[model samples]
Target: MSNLLSTPYLDRYTVNLTKKIAQNPDNYRAYEREPVTNRVLVSLLKKIQNSPLLVGEAGVGKTAIVEDLARQLLASNDKLLANKSIIQISLANLMQTSDGESFAYKFQQILNELMANKDTMIAFIDEIHQIVGTGADNQGSALDAGNIIKPALSRDDLQIIGATTTKEFHQYIAQDGALMRRFDLVEVPELSFNQTANILKKVSSQLGGEITVSQEVQDQIMTLSQRYITDRFFPEKAIMLLDGAISQAKLNQRLAVTTEDVADIIHADYHVPKYVINQTTDERLANLSQRIKERIIGQDHPLDKLTMKIINREAGLTDSSKPASFLFLGPTGVGKTETAKQLGILLFGEETNFIRFDMSEFKFASSSFERFKDKLTTEVRHTPYAVLLLDEIEKADPEVMDLLLQVLDDGRLTDAYGRVVNFKDLIIIMTTNSGAKAIQNHHAKSDYIKNDQKRQENFEEQLEIALQGDGYRPEFLARIGAMIIFDVLTLADIEKIVALKLKTLDEKAREQGFHIIFEPSEVLQYLPSFEYGYEYVEGQKVVSSSIAKYIADVGYRPSRGVRPIDDTIDVYIGDPVAQAIIAKRAGQLEDFNAFIFRALGNPPSLTSPYGEWQTVISRTKEGNYEVI
Candidate 1:
């Protein structure tokens, strides 16, 4: 671990600087051609003549150079009075506050305090250009702030060090000759990757950790992150990442940091900013779809088709003048509505992007079409790139559909006032349990009816099917690019989906800094219990109330979802007596060993009419009995 950091004075901030080597024997690091720059800066410091400007690239140590010089000036010069003062002030903090005050107000008081302490003045201002219009009451050129600074610049004992970017310096300070004439300016160029690498290596040594991060790892981190590293931000983050990797390695009981480890740490902890956020909408949409798949299992075909449409609509953001809309139709408890909510979260950085209006909430307004456009206008402006979800689209009066024709076709709307509302960047998702009974019958229906009464019952079923059949308008269907039919979640998908939820619970356990690993059978037990209601057709969903009911009954009925084979799960299963039967020592043993695939129900029964298996486990006279 002590590969290079153990050398004396190298870990500490201050050391003698006049000689290339430290005044005392100690291993140290110097920047690329930075010594020459340091010497130039040191030379400027000694000239107590005009105002001195110390400009440099961020993180290249503009502030450090001044600190080093101040240390040398006081320590080296016997004539240098203890009364001489060197103060550091951050200019950016002043601008960020409201009711801004001038930096000049404290100027004289600061100087007096420094003189009382017997310190000569060296006031270093970081980001000095922020005060271009320094005088608060009246707006004036930066010269006014500069002119206020002029008196301090004229003093015989005073020495000023101002740091700023070359571009900003030229625009604000350099333009005013009166301000420019008082101080001498210096340029600080950005360092190459090699130079940056050296500084990070030194920082590792200083922090007392032996981390030999591979050059390739460093290269990727720097390359992916270079643009955001401007003005001192680069070295700080890289060193911290290295430090984190070292800490993680130690905790995981590893000998040294590896390349893969650093990448994982960075991706998890840092959000590397891209230069132009281009095609980001499409990328965001794709990530959203992936996140959904992770949460909702076993609908690959439908998920794929629907995700493609979401991606296509997102791609339209590139040419926002032409935007697309969407409509989702399916049976109750399917994921049609949940998909919209999830997309809003992924795309807009939160769930706020989509404002769902239950079609029934607006059903009354549907009777009066004139008020419709006004309500949509107000909602649209608040959530510009919003997903306007019209739930129960079929329940809406025919009049509402008449107005929807405009929003669906043109990506634009005309309000009652004749004001135009553009929806070129909006995404519309409509969901309903519209054709549930018909969908249910399509998947499972009896064609035979004997008596006239039986024949009448059959007619009602057929009529419901006909309402959503081929006779349904082609224009309505064509307007919606992707209408995913959600079938009742099959046992496999529901099992897999519940497994994902259990995994989430495990993650939350870890985040709370605890250990949790569930036995495979615990969550698998909840799957078949979802089989009672949802009947999948061309459209069905087990996501909403059905899911809520199932979860409330099954997931929470146990202790935080680790339900034992016992009927202790009292809440959601809707069977309290059955719960008492499962926890019986013999019965519980039987249930845990039991395997009930979809069709094999009775012989391997997990639940009796009274309660779950009699008990989870029981001990025999010899020390082992049975698990149900």
Candidate 2:
């Protein structure tokens, strides 16, 4: 035990920098060129009590800067570090021993050794924050490692270089005034794009000799990593992308990394849709509006404005930190939700990427918004690139609306656990019925498309007032790219919706080997006659004039919306046909066409061999369906 105190502790717990550098020269090759290296050296050369504390975010090259300083000290002509050695002391290793001794004893022996060779030694401590409160039974212990080293550092008894993250520096070292004052802090920021590009090139030159990375591929790595890799800081994120691209090339038994190769790696690493990242802007813009229009009928005003915003975003004109956000204002069943779904399909290439939350669900109960907040953050974190539809935004509680401010303003949300969820890659759509009354009033007086420019301006002005009345702040509206007013569906628009819905139903029936056709007039007759100044009734629809007259006498009418068409089709068409098919009343359904519509008789019947007989579907005087 006495001999251990006499012998030096360097052989057991410290790695000699001179020997390590001699054995592996490549480790310091790129380090010398890194910008942080100069700052570290300057900190070390201070006039009094010089020990550089490298502080930065993790993976921003703090430890690497220390190593570069070590390399520089070894290669320099200056006597302070010339022929002198830098050895990294493992604080953890010093705390443990087979020999029975207090942790204070072992800590003192290591310090004594450094003191003996102080002039010729510089000690490096990585994760230097561990020195505080370690090897102590509790906080404020006199025998702790931090207390043992304080006097040595104060008198310049040992030159030490310490590395830790900015968080740890404040958490550990800043607490003790005596220990904190001894070292100068060197802040290492993340490398710039040009610097990161150079590092990637040097890395490829060093280890990726067999696989070539083109200049175009390097630029792509820099852009993609900066944009998509949110959880990590600079150069590290860029380097990871480069490494992944090289691996991808090798996996495919290829030699060179092209732009496509880098893109493929990014897609796999971040799960960004390949088409979204790789498609040319012109091509995407050319087909976007047409494709969205196929599923979203009417509302061409919103569609056109939305198309422009999307094209601008895709072309990289706006700030990338904020997501593309839109507030869809109008009445129910006016293609608001459908526009969001179609947008999801257009951008992400799938309907499953559409995330919808009925904001009304978060309005009533005390814990409902809390539960919804957690769910919303989790879903967006996992599916960062998606269409998030907040339906009935006006129905949500004010507290729930507060949660969206960060998302709408910064394009990021910090969850309860402090993890940042990125929304920059998302398309956020918030639908509301706040402006419905105003829109309905205007549409009843004039054609929705009349003098389109003035109409849109007036609509926007009126909708803005309604939204403000509903408690949305003007700043919240400003953050959104557009507040698109989905137009009220006219009879013609409803007809188009009916056809689209029937087409979808027909496809489903075809899958089951049944051929079905609808008599257009019969379906049209069932559509409620929506006209100017008409009032909407609940649970009752005027399918024919007799019913309309009767309902008018009572001063009630079904509102203007497309949802009734779907419900009417389901009742008058879908239900009766399914019943007939089950009963075998529509004989030999397969390989024979069956017609579904309002019937001529008291009970609705499905007619087979549909086109052979001239069946005209019409409304009787008694407000009933008749086939003539």
Candidate 3:
């Protein structure tokens, strides 16, 4: 090893590759990347242009190919490379001098040694882009490192192998036509999935201890890293995952590595939930519709369609590249956004996996569109398996809508920085009020309940016409998996929503050490029913009005959907209950265990309907009423 670096100038600023290979032979032997290694070797064998510039993305085995070439040279019968010694020149050490002249002198000495033994030595420079204009001065002498080496390279006096990333190669080396043309370019691409898995298997075998990785675990590492770890390329990312999982197993003093070990590493590094990483596809999506329905109150028709489309995509019955995209058409404050949230929770195991963008914020200008594109690409790149909800999408600028065409079509969008963000794992839901007035009009018809199927079909046709009038392109509509129409909430649905909200309120109260009970569990039913219009009888027909219309007439506004119900609960129930609890605490009512919420009126009967009702909250032991 010392003899290989025996030259004073070479020993001062370079590493001898042949010696490192001899010391740890297995590191260079396990997976040689034979195709790339042969490319580098064949280029090095050329007489006119013997140097090869290896350009690839990071972690794609550019440096490994060079090391493997050296290893092959040591045992080869090819006369050109058999006597060659590959030395890596360290640019950092060479540029340690004070000025350009001193640096140029040191580099010239290293070049002199290479020139004297040009037939027996080959130079390897990693991150070789740094060599271009490295030591250029304020004066116009082109005596920099790259310029000094060009003559020897062109004259075939020095055989060199240079490696750099694709970005750096274009940014720096490609600028100098004279220097760039001297070396043959060997473009190295990332390895395929099967290639990466084979490499992991070989590397795991080299572990050779009680700590073992099953073939199943290796397959998972490759698949998950390829899917979730999008910022990097394989087999490097896969190797890192394998190493981290093995380290985890060793820390726990376990003899065998499991899939959970790999999942934990992914969860920690990428923020993907452990359940998502650990579970199989079918397991994660098991009972998916039922799980969503548990949180979302109504809109079963749209939910059913959404569930089926997702299942179809997962089963490969549809285009698997793009996400399962949908346009949720309806009035605001319905279950559209809530359904998206529920899907996020049910599919990804948490609420944070739901990403939302209020498109109204991007409606003004091109600058806003750029901001939206940046944020959208970055978030999707980080969390590929999220439910992306674009609320009020009809309000966005035309440019922003244009941007989504590619995302819906290809399941990817390259950002301002030229990164292709993958949306294949996302569930894209866009909500709009473009046809809200039509839906509300249909719901208000006299026979809406009895003829719902026909009414819904008519409503959909009206909605497509309205969307087309609003300038929504036909191609965009065609790309969506479904344009699900969320219907106006019925009185029964609002009642269920109120109950769900009250359950949440009760949980909150219990968390603070007190319980809340809705007496009879139907005490809040009066909120959904109201009295307004007078009834009449005309010509043997009875004229009647519904509770839904009465509520709407009295400004309860059921047409606006569940938001009014939420506001009603917060004002009539939540605020009063909170105030009563505070007042009880102020009065030193610590012994009270529960608060009873009930209506202070006669329960409605056919003979005594239309009576006024008041909601009241009472502490159990205090027996004091807080009335509303």
Candidate 4:
């Protein structure tokens, strides 16, 4: 404290850290007492190499460690840095205010000022990596800030302390071999959960108001901050979380910080809500299968397995760093993508939380990686707590698959700006049609699909051979929890799906001021039929419209699945009904009834009380389907 008054060199720098340490001595005591700070002090006080280079990740207290050294030198009467100014230099401010003074000239003057008081003064450079190429012209001169300081650093005349991130240390400092060896490196690690909790408690005490924090809240804050707040490190992020919670508690007129208060603050800061992390697995798992089945049809096998994995994830039994990744390998038009949408709504409470990437669009070799970088990382980063669907994985370029391997294994991807986008809270579902042919062949011959136990085994074996033959690497396949194979929709399954589709069609009809009913037929010949190969046409609307056309033009086949039934209904049933409503044909058709009329020789006509009515007479000059 007495030494600061004697040193006039501190006046040149904007901040006199030594004098500031005197004002609030306790503020710097915590860092001074830390073990890493002692190590840095030992390095800076060495006989030959007196400079200490502090290196660590951002927010890991590298600069704090250096400040501790300053505080200690001021408080104690140590000869090494005692009676020294310990003026901290901001490289940015130094260069900014050089005022036409040459970079070399400005740095030399500072070095001369410090060296003149050799044993009594020390210069601290924070973000010291900025020195490497401080003032280099296009001609590439080596007369930079680092080079200027190298001679002084090597001579042991100008005592200096440096702090920088590990990334910049290697990138900038390590490039200059001579300058690198001059300082002893001190690596500071991020504080552990317990250590961070201790620091938060100490901070709360020092503040001494209504900001009382319990050990449990601090522990939870540590865990939550580490998981959700990927961009920041421990102690720093934990402290921010705790302080923010304290501020929120004060604003609410609360006395102390509660877990709920901390959670609310964190939820506000990061969109990841507390309900997501602390979900009630008991109730969710109990109704998981039933909830999923309501949306998906004929995927009981895969759906059950997926539900179990989700239960395990929600139960906190699985790895938090890696998401519960699954590969939905099956034929087209199965409930693979639909299951993802349903799961998104189930887990995240909204279907909009489902983010999808159509791998078919990423087939081009040139733009595949760009698409992956642009959409995958950006979307996941924005909505970390959502379901990501990569549809039609087989159609994607191998580069896309290669890029996905890291995300599958680690649940993280470095974005273009070098930010790590977290996927631990995400449910990733990748659907592929790579093994559709083999799966079809297996079901065509074997009756083992009826047995759930043997069915999974047979499906697995066939898919393994199919995917391996298709050149999907085994390592990539191994990371996924399961490669769920969806069976081809059977006639019974399609009938159930048709019933479901009709319920939707009925709702739409009622919305438009009409009520259409499907007249019960013994064999549901009213719906469109799917042949063996062309069974997967995607939606019920297409199915109904196409089926209505098929029944009127071609007629239903016995082996047809439920594909395109909605299309048939829309074209023959919906279009005709809408036209009748517009034409005011209320007397002729008092009600709309859809049924299969297999009048072998009779033209496609609706047997009505008014007269014979063809379903599709012809397109009128006004471009309306003339149904009468």
Candidate 5:
């Protein structure tokens, strides 16, 4: 067996694994892949079906197992593998011609050589699925490489270890029954977190240079790889991250590899925010509510509930598999979508991490639902840690809801192509206007008062009833971590929002070398007031006869919440200021220092309804409109 017949064809197109290992013994250091390698060895020693098909995800160490088996055989006392050498058939070299006859003849010569030297040579084909139709003259040709080697494989005359991804194995080899039954299937699964960590440590020790990876850095590598690099399997991704960090450290002339090095690589490759990569989990979760509140105004109660659930989830008090999910029940334009956006910024350190899906677009049919699933799964696979906002969830089709139920329950979704996208790191938010009418009706009640806790509780109960009436299943609602009902915008909230809008306008004006300022108090005085009479004294509610100033009167309506304010600003301030800047740039108007928007005494007009004061934008403090 040690001195078999000459193998000219094998020598021409195959790589001698034993000779390669003998050349560099240090390169084949064993990790935790021994079990898989032993399985392959046992398959080769079998009296029947001596070939083994290595099935696993890409980068899950299928090829490595074969190489490790070769290394083990190089030092083993077993007679079966004493003189046997594992030779990998170079598919690239063997399939050098497209002509069916040429390739089939070449592959047959190689198979014949393997059969002649079966006692001393074992064959290994990486990506063995490629051989299925290799060198076929046409799509209907059956005389391909796979068919040519079937006789040898069926008789067990050649011990061939084939490796391919599970997807390819099913797509190609599993379809051919004759080719499928000849090889014993050895499944290789992904390594666990601790196993991957140990592999990284082993590889780090072998660096053996000025480049050194600390234990903490190795741990971070494993964690980040598992968390952010969802598209790839463990050990390989972690090792790649470790290698990249070490390469970066060496390139910068540094002796030690730090966490920053790992963070830099992950941030550059995955577009994960540098702050998110560098910050610890607790640091990322600190002051979450306060940070979100800075951007989302007048949603304190909802924000409080949302943040509490988030904190609890991050603290491991909730289901670890499922994502931190919430259903935002509210009227239009009441900071529902904005809250989701702010959460993305606060948690993931970037606003782009907020992914929004308008469920209205997915309401049509099963095809539309398929499209939604494709987009959702693809995006989450790419950016696992982000905020996913499904806008107007009620508008989505029932089929789409079925898909979401799976995600909400399992924290993972399998796409049509059988890839499971992880949602555990996502913040799932679904917003709906299902209870909007109920909210508006509750607020329209004459007894509605500011800071009325009991009224607020009653409003929530009404909203829940409304949601149930809107066809939401009980189990669907129950799976949501929290159902936060957004309160209607108040007069004070509108004033603050107006100030924010005006500030934005002023910044835009400044970009054109002009200054603009809006007197918030004077501006609020001119906006129309709502037809409700109410006031607050200390913590007590009081009834009044005077008109009440609510957000609705200023433009925040039930159908279009706060949108009129945006349009009003665009028309009155943004448009006028833009015109003024354009006129100045064209030398059509006199240069003005600043435009002040303030309310002043209006001329007597019986038809006017803006009270006794009118809002004006002028160039002076005397309330003159000369700039116009």
Candidate 6:
């Protein structure tokens, strides 16, 4: 449709026209316009011409609907637009300060003139909610429109259209019973997705910008805005975006808005609420073969064949929506935690995709089942995918496995909170030291026996060496789609793990503006560290200070890696000697050696001084050290 430009000049209309100009189409603006499907609303407005008024959600298109109806009426009549026509009045704006004849007299005078030719004009009184305060001075407490507007309507000439945004419109224009019956109530829906997009487009055109958004961008905007932006008067916001885009483009001397420009515009509108979508999730099953080789190490065929079967069925290579859960019965430091994390990162796009639960904390299956059920549901709704980690499943009050029968069979569980968690969308990974060996060694040998009757009867003496251990029920163990046994880490594996852990810490430090590096990691990479380095004492895994203590003892390795001071094992105090010369030492062999030597001791971990504030550490050889 072409622009509606017939609205001519009127001294009194100057401000209204200016408002329209400000809101009209321009580049870098939100689109606004008459929607194509307002037919019912148009008829409602015409019917109100001889009657009362209608009010609804403030700032929604009540007035706009009336305006469009007026336009349509003029078009149909063909001469109404050119002749003595429709007039709208705001009583508050018209009341003069002069009290000689009273404001009511002036209001009545204007109304008298508006309906002078009663058979030809339509006057709409707006802001009708102001009726309560008007009658305080005594010429009575009401500006009853029934008597005032009846002159024209009785002769089939007096017609009025009243619009208001407050519920109290009924109080202001009191014609009561018969009068209130005359007007038809009409309502308008908030702008739809397409309407909002069009509004932005038109506003951009008005601003004289050539940029336009694609459907994809509009889709994203609508999806996000629906959840954040309140549905209200959007004209101001529309102009702000346009002005913002124009200002940004002028500053950069750019002719068109790129996607980056649009993002900046939107960011300005809402900064804190917009979340950044991190790494993308690549399907774990797709690359399960390779990850198993790297992370599980030595367990190739068992991992591959098992992973393939589970992956195929869930990937719709089968006809079911259900995903199977698996319990890995193996020794500690194997790859249970690492595998789950890897798969989460693989399937959900980040290494932290796994939601881990330490079974030691869950003494009863009922409570673990309850807490886990809520966390999983809420997390999945906000985040597309997750890997549920049941660390050391056997340690969880062995009866907890009793609860698993239902979950394993149906891939779901109803928690105490009454929330039904659907596990079909999740891939549950549980690790257990439940085999007949590990449990027997610990005092928890009785935890695995499924039978209450057989468990109490001389169970201690009756069990054979293998039967004495903690093993899961055959049916319970079978639910896991795949089982990758984690071998006790060889000393070599521990060394590799420690080295990797240190390397990760260094990277983190560098990102925080620390220039230190750990060269001693390679020196400590001897075999057997993985084999005997870590041990499960009671329920806790303890890897003494050799790696952790050495880092802590070193004290001041530029204060980059050794932050945690738990158990005096992981890290230690700072080296005063190294701290004094750290700012001075650079480039020489002694400088590097002195720094490494100082960081050999365990150091106490310090909390981030400011909860939210963080230091940014960028690294470059040229910037950090003159000698390196």
lDDT of 1 by residue, 413-439 (tens): 766665556666567777766565555
lDDT per residue (tens digit) for residues 442-503 in model 3? 76777746277876677677789899899788888888889988878876676666667777
True-vs-predicted CA distance for residue 135, candidate 6, Å = 6.9
Q: Candidate 4: minimum summed lDDT over ten consecutive residues — where? A: 617-626
lDDT per residue as tens, model 2, 1-628: 1222243567866888767886675676544245567666666666676888888887777666666666666778876666566788888787676767667787788788888877677788899999888788766566677888888888877778888878889988998888889888878887777888778778875656788888888888888898778878777888888888888888888988878778887777777777767865586568788888888888887798898898888788888788898998777888899899988878787777899999988886588767877999899887788899999887888778877876778788778898878888888999988878887777776555655788767777877977898899887778788778777776456656666777687677667655444534444444334222122235453222222112112221126466666666565556655664565544643323344332221111265322221122232333443332
- Residue 519 in model 4: shift from native, Å? 12
lDDT of 3 at 200: 91
How do the predictions measure up, each by TM-score?
A: 0.38, 0.78, 0.81, 0.78, 0.79, 0.44
Candidates 1 and 3 compared: the better one by TM-score is 3
Give the local distance difference test score of model 4. Answer: 0.70
The residue-by-residue lDDT of candidate 5 on 1-628, one tens digit each, is: 5567887777777889889987877788658887888888788888998899999999888888888888888888888887678899877787676444377778888888888888888889999999898867876788887888788888878889999999999999999999999889999999989898888877896863668788899888988998788769987899888888998898788999988889999988876778688787799888888887777778887898899898888788888888988999878888898889888988888877999999999999857788999999988877777999999999998888988998999889887789778898899999998988877776676754635888777767777777889978878888888888788887678767777767777887777777775644433332222123222335554332211122223445657777787876776667877877788788997657567564344322468544453345656333333535
lDDT (C-alpha, whole model) for all candidates:
0.51, 0.72, 0.78, 0.70, 0.79, 0.47
TM-score of 3: 0.81
Find the 10 residues in a row with the least total lDDT in model 6. 610-619
lDDT of 4 by residue, 1-628 (tens): 3332333324554466777887876787553236887786677678888788888889887766666667777766776556666778766655654377666666777777777767676788989999998866568897888888888888888788888988999999998888899998888787777777777777775653646777787777887887778778866897788878888888888887888887887777877745565665475466879888987888887788888888888778888788888888767766678789988888876666799998889889988888777788888877788889988887888988888888888788888888878888888898887887777776676564656677767667767877878878888888887777787776556655655665677677667655544433422332224221121223322122223223424322323333456576566566765776655455654343332221112233466323222332222222222223
lDDT tens string, model 6, 104-185? 5655565555445443445565655453355345556555434444444444454556666554555543435544455544
Better of 2 and 6 by lDDT: 2
Query: Hey, what RMSD does candidate 2 come out at?
Result: 8.4
How far out, in Å, is residue 258 in model 2? Answer: 5.9
What is the Cα-based TM-score of model 4? 0.78
Candidate 5 segments whose C-alpha is farther than 4 A from its true place: 46-50, 90-105, 129-155, 166-187, 205-210, 250-258, 320-323, 362-383, 396-423, 444-481, 509-553, 575-596, 601-610, 616-628
